[model samples]
Every structure is written in C-alpha cells, then in structure tokens.
Target: MRNFLYGAITSAAIATLTVSTLTVAPALSAERLSLSTWGSPAHYQVAEFVPMFKQLLEEKSDGDIRLKTFEGGEMVKQQFVATAVPQGTIDISLTTLDNWSGRVADVGILTTPLWDKSMEWTRDNLKPGNPVFDYFDAKLRDEGAIIIAMFDIGAPVVSTSFEITGPEAFANMPIRAYSKGSAQVLQTLGAAPTIMGVGDVYSGLQRGTVKGAMGGLGGAVGLKHYEVTSNMFVPNGVMGTLIHAYVMNKAKFEGMSPENQKILMEAAAEARDHMQQVAIDQLASLLDTVRENGNTVTIVEPGSPTWEAFAKQLEPLAREATQSYPQEVQDLIAAD
Candidate 1:
C-alpha cells in the first residue's frame, strides 16, 4: 500500500512537469529589442504603457523578439532619446519632442498647438496620409535616425487641485510649463510660466514651488498632483504630446531580416495607435476622476470676446516663432 501511494504521487508530479514543459515558454532569439521611457517607473506616464506594449509586442512576435526596457533617464538621457536611438545607445523609446526641441524644431512644432489640435490629428494624419511622418521622416534621416511611428499621445492640460475658476485666477502663479508654447500661452494669460519637465511637477507642488504644470489628465491623476492642487482648466491649454517612435539604429535596422523588419514596424504602429486611443478615450474620464477627487474643471470660452482678446495677446508670438522655419513648413502649419 505504501509503495502504491508513493508511485501515485510520483506519477502526479511527472504529469505536472510534462504539462509545464509542453506549454511553450518564450524563446529568446539572437535579436533583441530595447525600449526606454522618459521618467521613473512610478510615474504613470510611462508605467501605464509598458505592460500593454510588452504584451502586444512579445505576443505578436511569438516571444522570439525580446524587449529589454530601461526606465527614466537611465537608458538614455531624457533629452537625447532622438539622437541616441539612431546612434545605437538604445533600441527604441517614447521620446518627447520638446526634450530635444532644439535639434528637431519641426518635430517640436507638432507637439505645440502650432501644428496639431490634439492626439487625434496626429493619429489621423499619420495612419493613412502620413504626411507629417513623411515630412519628419526625411528630417530624421538627415539627423542620422529613422522614426518608425509618430503619434502624439501627450495630451498636455493644466491641472491644479484647487480652483483655477477662470483665466484671471491663475494669471500670476508660478505654473510649470513643459514646452515653450505652453509657457508663452500661460505668460499671455498673465501667469508666471516656469519651464520644467513633467516628472518635476509633482515635486514642485509638494515644495510649494509651482502652482501647477501643463500636462494631461492621466498625468495629473497618476502623479497624485490632484492631492495638492484641486483645479483643472480645459481649453486653457492643450498640446498634443508629439509621440513615441520605434527607432532603431540605422545600421541595426538594416541588419534585421525582412520578416523581422516588418514585425518591428507593425509593432511600432500598434504601440502608437494604442497610445493615441488611451490619450483620447481616457483624458475626459481622467478629468472626471480628478473632479470626483474634489477638483474643478473649467473650459475657457473660445468664442467669448475675452477669449478672443486672450488669443490675440499670444498669436503674434506664435506666428513669429514659425517664421524661423522653412517656408513650406510655415505654409503647412499656418491656420487656413
């Protein structure tokens, strides 16, 4: 009876082992992919994306393609993603156009209100027309790089946990601004626009340094800035986050098999689409959550004379900034 019981246990264990081995674990091929994001792992901007993308890519590739990820500024400095990925320091990443705006002024134009209205404009233009991507793709190659996907997932808005009831209420506070346009827009409203990155906004609030920062509702809710500042203003400001690119060092990209190249491009497209959907679908709901948490949402009236005056105050500067670009670039962006 004892021998029979032992044999029964052994048989069960062997059966489990066989089932596990038969499940087809992920296989790492010689080729690997690397990804980098702009901020710390705890920051919701990048964290919310990693799992979704990893699953999408790994599953799509059937585990033969491995993605090695680095978070924050470690993989590549926040400002160097565009230059570095093409130079082979990192394989891919969600690079901010504003970070290296100096190097790629045209790309920066896309991120600012100057180029597009929202993430939807970015996705739509690139999905089929791809005019913007084509324009910048030429520019990127000139800079020793290739941009596989360009989707503006960054939906920058103003959020302060307290009430920024109207334009006048925030006119004089030290608000953190990520882009030059966001800063200038705030300045036009009579606010002290301080330039800083998104990661710093939460800390800036904690230290009593910045009243608010211009970013998306996802960021405001995810970063817990709602805990400090309770007001979120809409149409006050919104910049479509320029995008993430599935960039590969030019030589490395060229080195891959045709099949692998196709997979990489497809993965990039999927990731870009995912980011756009998240930004568009979730932003209002995120704002709602912010309101539920005791914050207020106010939409600056676009047709009001006051709004017209406010826009007039800032329009010339926007026009002047665009003049430095190529003529065609200007013509393409000028409001028709």
Candidate 2:
C-alpha cells in the first residue's frame, strides 16, 4: 500500500507540475494551484467547503486562478501536508493543526484536552485578526506555510463496543487517537492509546487492532466508524474541539497579486463560516443516525465519575502542554 501510495503520489506530482527547473514558478496569468486534501469526498470539508472555495476563487479571479485538486491522500499523506505545501510539492493543503506537530511541536499545545470546547468560541477567537490567529500565523510562517482560514470538528468522543464512561473503564481498552496530546491524555487516563490516521481507522477497528477511537460524530459518519463501534461516550469536551486550518505555501501566497490574495482570504473565510454551520447543524441529526443504527449514546455529565476522571487525569496534562505557550493563549483556552 505504501509503495502504491508513493508511486501514485510521484506520478501525480509529475503530472500536476511539468516544470523542468528545480524552483517552482507561480503563474501570474491563468494561475493553476494544486490544492490537496486528505478529506473523504462526502466530508463537509470536501463536499461543501472546498467546492465553495473553488467556485469563489474562480469567479472572484475571473477564471484566471484555478485549483488542481487532489483529495483523500492521493497526492500527499495527511501528516506530510504541512511539509509538502511549503516545499512546492503542493500549492495548498488542508489539515488539522495537530498534524503540524512534526514540524512545529508547539502546535501540539493547541490540542490541549478540554481547551475551548465551544465551537462558537473557536470560531470567534480564531478569526484572522484574533490572537489565536496571530499565534498560528507566526507558527505557520516559521514553518513556511500561511493560514488561509480555520474550521473545526466539535468535541470528539470515544466510540467503543463497551462503555468508557470513566477512567476505570479505560483499563486494557485500546483507544485509537489521532494527535500526540490526545494520546498522552488517554494514556494518563489509563487507556492504551495508539496513533492512526483517520483513513486507516475503520480497518483498524474491523480487525480489533484497536477497540475504539476518539473522533467526532461527523467524522465517524463520514468514515463509517459507527459501523464497527457500538457505543459513543461523550465525556463533555474531553478532547476539546478539533481545529483544522487551510494552509498554503508561504512563497506561493506571496507570489499572488494583493487583489488575488484578498480574494483567497475572503473566500476562505466565507467557506469556513459555511463549513462550521454545516457541521453544527448536522451533528445532532448525525448522532441520531448513530442511535438509529443500534449504537448506544452515552453523554457523561460534568460532575459524574467519568467527568471527574477526566478532570483528574486530563486537566493537568492540558495545563502541562500549554505551559510554554503565551499567557494570553493559555488564558484563552482556559477561560470558561
């Protein structure tokens, strides 16, 4: 699979950009940027947001700007997207900030458990002018990428055959985690947490390689995770909201005309708003579908044994993870 994926990506790279020189050139006329993503075609990020983004870019640029899209890891792997975009392997890519940890370890701090659980809070605070945005911009600039916009998955839950309502329930249960911070928190809570990309999780669950995963309902539905797991334990923002940013190559962005740059940023913001609403409106209905499909939904209360276990195990870890981040950044996440 790895060989096939690599071969496909190499072929796609060659086909996408037929440049003879080592330095990649950004076209001023009829600009065609390669936009890659790891999202499923059905996922809102792909289905709703990306299409809107493409439409907006084309219309706003009078068809001068075009996107050459490659979805679902066909062009670049999820974890390597940050690197790929900056190195001119791809012009733009969308991925979670947590996945940027390999290049910028400070990004892991942004996933500190139970930090900014409210989707609205995330939306308002992560806008282009906000401190969170500034921090992320500086971080991404340092990593050779620039933030186009931010979108999210609300509080992630654990889907398993058995209930994991409390820390005691975590014993011996292997939980699939996507980020280093979440894995550490789950490990602190006594679960055996293993890292896996979202694309490989369904097979992992099927083979019992992992009993369950920490993921959003939207993501579970998108990936058919509910087909394999029986129960979803919602530990009230236990893992916080999942924040994904649309990031582009810094140099590529710099090469764009100021007017084109404005259009890109505006379009990204518009698409971000639409994606957030789609996610918010679809979540409850999606959860209902999960219930109708014969899975149990367990919503853990704030003061329950499960919640207490999370506070005891996950809270301190959150604090530890964000210790080096700016005080305001810490305060923004810690605020009620």
Candidate 3:
C-alpha cells in the first residue's frame, strides 16, 4: 500500500509540472507584430522583400518577435496606409511618398521631374543620412509614423495602345495616372491625365477609357497590360523613379525595447538593399516577358536627344512644383 501511494504521488507531480509548463510556455512566446501591405501576393515586395524582412527580424530577435502580415490591402487600401498607420489601424505598412503628398508636400520633391536619376544614383542618395531623406523623415514623423526603409519599384515606364517614340506621342492622348505627380508628368507632355488605382488601369485600358498607363514594367507584366497595350516606352529615368517606404506606427515603434527597435531597423535596411537589386533583375525579366508577348518595347536612353528635350520641356513645371519646398531642398534635388 505504501509503495503504491508513493508511485501515485510521483505521477500526479509529473502531470502538474507538464500542465504548468504548457501554460507558462505560451506566455513566454514571441510577441507578434501586425503588418499590412497593399501589394498582391505575387508582387515582388510581397513574395520576396516581406518574407526576407520577417525572417531577418525573427532571427535577429532570437525568436523574441514574430510578424503577421496582411497582403493585398486586406486591412487597408494602398492609398489609405499612410493615414491608417498614424491612426493605429495597422502597426506597420508600406506607402509611396506620392500618397503622402496630400499631407506633406515636401515628399512630392521625390516625385518631381527634377528627380530623373538612375537607380544606382537613387540607391546612393535616398538613404538614411541624406538630406532629402532627413527632410522627408521629419515631415513623416510629424504625421505619426517613422520610415524604416525606402526602396524603388523601378524606373517609370508607360504602356500605350499606340507607339511612342518621343514626348509628342503623348500629345492629346488619354493616359491613366497612378498619382498626382504622375498626372502632372502626363499633363506636361500634353496628355490628358486621369488619376486611377493600379487595379483599375487594366479594365480602364480594355474599355478604352484610357489609351495608356504610367507605371513600372513589373506592373505591366503583373497586370498583363501587354495584352491590351501594344507599345511600352521605357524612357528609363526621364519620368523619375517610384519610391516606396516601409513605415511603423510612431507610438508602437517608440514603445518597443531599444534592442528590438534596432533589430527591426537593421532587418528592414537589409531587406530593402536586397530587394532593390531584385527590382533591377525583375525589371529585366519583366521586359523580356513584355517582348515575348509581342509588344514593341521602346528604350529611350537617358541623355539621348529625345530624353534631353523631354527634360527641358519639364524643367519649368519642375521648378513650379518644387517652389514650395525650402531652397536647400530644391538645390539638393536639382543638383547633379
């Protein structure tokens, strides 16, 4: 009887320990952060950059932090992410500077015609310590978010039903513009600019509501714009590059432990750098896809006569658009 009682007590003690561990383990598990992105799952930033950031952050944090992502505007629309982050609708999100232009006009500097620089030049100049970045970051902070990383989608390209050899091709043409800056560019070229969502451009093209669309090559491939548009004008940097930033809610970011904050920023920077190269390679692949689809691809080399003339035509408009910014910002952006 004594031996049996001792065995029963040991079994009970073992069961209690197991139950305690199961309950306590969950309490010690990694803290989860929520991130929402407007890109579809197939988008490079969704498929590549976000995953890379998640892995790097988790590894760097030693599993102390985990991310939960909502892609394809599941939580907030692309245009609203800038506002949503500040309202704490999402802890983190990706936003284009142009989208923030309504709230912060200085961000429009990046979208101005004066910003016609190569991807390499952009990568070098639009980084953490740069004057442009500092100026924009301060503005964004006042609106309640912090920029962790900034990257380009690619050089801007335009797809049209008609052929485009030079700026004159845009004359009186109806083109879909994704933002006010893009609309301004199209208008300067004498085209009728209609601002629309990225998803709506495909249907708009099919319905003949718009004759051309301004965006990146990756967008052309992803949306299969080549099916409806016969010509793709790759003026490379003449139209300026599209910029997107990964941002975190200011309160959430500030509330984090300094160690975790450092990890998040480091991971974001690493992911941004890696994805910028991916964007370049992806653009090349996407161009091939456009060609394979039997579309004419026009390469307007930067500094060529046509590109130079296009730049000169846009110079006055660029000056007017940037007049609101500080002279230092205007000089810095306009500088070679």
Measured with C-alpha atoms, the lDDT of residue 30 in candidate 1 is 39
Model 1 TM-score, all chains together: 0.78
Q: After superposition, how far is residue 316 of candidate 3 from its true place, in Å?
A: 2.1
What is the lDDT for 244 in model 1? 50
Q: TM-score: which is higher, 2 or 3?
A: 3
**lDDT agreement with native, every candidate:** 0.66, 0.79, 0.82
RMSD to the hidden true structure, all candidates: 6.2, 11.1, 2.5
The numbered model that scores best in TM-score is 3
lDDT tens per residue, model 2, 276-330: 8888778788888889888899887767776776777776786676665667656
lDDT of 3 by residue, 6-65 (tens): 999999999999999997785487667889887446667666779999999889998888
Give the Cα error of residue 25 in candidate 2, in Å: 18
The segments of candidate 2 whose C-alpha lies over 4 angstroms from its true place after superposition are 1-28, 303-305, 322-328, 331-336
Error of 1 at 233 (Å): 1.5
Candidate 2 accuracy as lDDT: 0.79
TM-scores for every candidate against the unseen true structure: 0.78, 0.86, 0.91
